[model samples]
Target: MGVAGSGKTTVAALLAGRLGAEFAEGDEFHPPENVAKMSDGMPLEDSDRWPWLGHIRDWLAEQAAAGRSAVVPCSALKRSYRDLLREAGPVRFAHLTGSRELLTERIQGRAGHFMKPAMLDSQLATLEPLGDDEDGFTVDVFPRPPEIVDEIIAHLDR
Candidate 1:
């Protein structure tokens, strides 16, 4: 998980397809109010995110209970947020990271998305890189989506 322009959705979807796991877009779990706030160029407070994170966590738990592996793309920016999601089960994160300029360019390139380039700074400021204790690997976003997915899968294999 990373910021908005980190290619989480694209890579996660491809990863899910390759693994034959259930896939969910994390943004869909956000309440309308959260979406509205982001759309209006306002960064969401932690209070606004708890419920949304809970919904995503619940969905992950549901998938695990059903005996299915699931892939979800989320901007899990904080260690606390990642900790909350870990309660769902054995969650492994793949943090897609890149330079600020690259992230801004990617965000600007998107269209019809609620997240805008102007909001990237807020997200970057909020992001906490995966800690050594975390069950995850960080991948550079410079690679193609397939390459990124391949790297993540390779790490999982290790």
Candidate 2:
């Protein structure tokens, strides 16, 4: 999990492939209204995200129960959100982090996504960097997508 434009999707996809897990894009599960709100440059309130988070948790649990590991790309910007996800089971978050400048460039270069570049500020404002208590690995998104995936895998291996 990470902020927008941090290449979460790219890294998650590659990691899921390498791990033989089903890959799920968190954006795909967003409610239409949430997508519309983000598209209009509005940040989602906690109330707006609670149900969505629950949905993700349920999906993750289902996958785990099926004995299928899954890689999910989610922003999960808050500690509360991560706690909710953790309730699902032993899930590891691979956080992709980068400087605001780099993320801005990525957002600017992207096209046709529901999340507008303008919302980046709100996202950053809301984000609480992962704490020591969280179960995950943090990788800076600078080298390359493949390198990011490799880093995540290396971390998980430990």
Top-TM-score structure, candidate number:
1
- Please list all clashing residue pairs in model 2, or write none if there are none: none
lDDT of 1 by residue, 1-158 (tens): 99988999999999999999999999999999999999999999999999999999999999999999999999999999999999999999999999888888898999999997888888888989999999999999998999998999999999
TM per candidate comes to 0.98, 0.97
| lDDT of candidate 2 over 31-87, digit per residue (tens) | 999998888888899988988888889899999999989888999999999999988
lDDT of 2 at 118: 82
CA lDDT, every prediction? Answer: 0.94, 0.89
Candidate maximizing lDDT: 1
lDDT of 2: 0.89
How does residue 116 of candidate 1 score in lDDT?
74
Q: Give me the displacement of residue 63 in model 2, in angstroms.
A: 0.6
